[model samples]
Structure formats: structure tokens, C-alpha cells
Target: MSFRSRGPRTVPLKSAEEVDAIVRKIRDDQTRPENYRERSLKLHGWICAKCGREFELSNLHLLTVHHKDGNHNYNPPDGSNWENLCVYCHDDEHSRTILADYLAGKDKKS
Candidate 1:
């Protein structure tokens, strides 16, 4: 006897409405900000891209996802725009962005 004869194939059956609901739920979850962060962490691991600091599970919460283009809604499944950064580096990145915007505005007035 082969492996195929050892057991029957099993398939899950669902109504059309049920399948639609499941698909909608999945899409909704994927669009959430938390889901993007989780995906980023998984894609890039727990090292801070900016500071080169590594984290363990105990300190993983200190690590955050940074959107390279500064758009939170631009998350891609391939994590092309995501960077894992520790809290300090993340804050520094945002601070630089803020300063740059302010300087640009000041320059526009001159």
C-alpha cells in the first residue's frame, strides 16, 4: 500500500457567503497598521536597521517599523518600504523629518 491508500483526502466545505466573509476578514486584517508592523518585523528580523542594534523577545517591543518614504499607508507585502528601527533611531528619524520640513518652509519664505 502507498501513502495515498493510508488515508482519504480531506477538504473543508463552506458556503459562498462564508467564503466571502472569510476573504473580507483577511483583507481587513491585512490593512491594519499592526499587521504591517508584524509583517515588517518578520521580514527584517529584530535588528534595528538604523542603529544596528539587535533585540531579543524580551525587548522586541522597543523595536518599531519605519516607513522609508514616511507614508504609513504605503506598506507592501514584500516590505520594500519598511525598516525595523529601535525606539531611539525611530525617534531620531522622525525628528530629522520634522526639522527638514520646518527648514523647507523657512526657505520658501526667503
Candidate 2:
């Protein structure tokens, strides 16, 4: 039996409005403050600042951006407030802060 040749594949076209919307969405996403994670990683390299743990793309998710001042909205473009922390180290750092607050009576029920 002879094999038949397949025809060229056809793609659906989007309207100009749809294309414009897609471009605007991409631009907004690029400008969002949440991108600080990427900026921090680039500025600090792929190592945990507290534990000195290195990360590769395969395990990058284990690395996280920790804000120095405990403010999620305080991301600065200069990378002054960000540190890359491995999940374990980041948890320990926050736990220490909580423990300090508890010991200092900051979390009193009054």
C-alpha cells in the first residue's frame, strides 16, 4: 500500500484585539513586583544566603526569596532587601523570629 502525503497544517488566527491584549498582559507581568524573585536570583546567584546551599534549575523551586525586612511589598530594584534562601533555611530564619517575639512577650494575648 502507498502512503499518502499529509497536507500543511493550518493555524487559527487571532484578532488584532486579542493580540494587543496578549502583548499588554505580557508587559504587565514583566513589570509586576512579584518578578523580584527572578531579579533577586540573578543578583544573588543560585545559593542559599543563610545555609550556602547551591541550586540548579532542576531544584530551583527549593530556593526562595526572603525579604530582609519581613515585608513582601518592600522589594527594591537594587536587590538590597532580598536574599535567596533554601526552603529549610528560610523556615528556620522565620521560626527564630517568631521564637524571639514569643520570648519577648510580643505575642501576648492581652
Candidate 3:
């Protein structure tokens, strides 16, 4: 008698805590890249992108270091097109897709 069985050639598993920790580390690195904060502030002229008005460094609360091409890791490649979006605009952009889906679902339910 001959038998053949096939399963995944390779499978990797990590505990939930390990996965969470890895994700948290990645997010932390992205949000606080080395020296990115200081360089970006100067590059953006210390102004709110949406308002186009100057603000003190302290007023730069909750500012998002926006990635113009939607590639957060791409690092702008150059300083030209990168922008500093305030929290309001940043959150708006980030939530657009989720908001659309939510609205559509609500509409269907109602």
C-alpha cells in the first residue's frame, strides 16, 4: 500500500502578543523616524498644510507627516512634494475610505 499526503511546505506562526509587538514596533519607527521630525518641520515652513498659515512649533500639535505619493516608507525621495498636514486634514484623508464604507452600509441599513 502507498499513501501520499500534502500540506503546506512551510508555515510560520507567532503568538498574538508577538504579532502585536512587532506591529507596534513598526508603527513606532514609522511615526518617529530618526530626525524626521526636525527636518520635516523646517521643510514644510512650519505651516499647516490645509490652512497655509504659519504656526508656532507648539501649535504643531497632532500634525501628520504626510506622504504625498501615499507611500509612507518612500521618504519623499526629495524634499519638494512632501507636505505637513494638520491633524484635521490628515484624519480626514485617512478616514475617507472607511467613512465611505460606513456611510454606504448605513444607507443600505436604513
lDDT of 3 by residue, 38-108 (tens): 66877777776886666676786767677667776666535554688777877777788568878778636
Per-residue CA lDDT of model 1 for 2-109, tens digit only, reads 554557878899999999999999998887666888889889999999889999999999999999998899988999999999999999999998899888785365
Cα lDDT tens digits, model 2, 15-51, are: 9999999999999988776589989999999999998
Pairs with steric clashes in candidate 1: none
The prediction achieving the highest lDDT against the true structure is: 2
The ten-residue window of minimal lDDT in model 2 covers 29-38
Clashing pairs in 3: none
**Clash totals, every prediction:** 0, 0, 0
Q: Could you tell me every candidate's TM-score relative to the true structure?
A: 0.64, 0.75, 0.49
Model 1: how far is 81 from its true place, Å? Answer: 0.9
Clashes of 3: 0
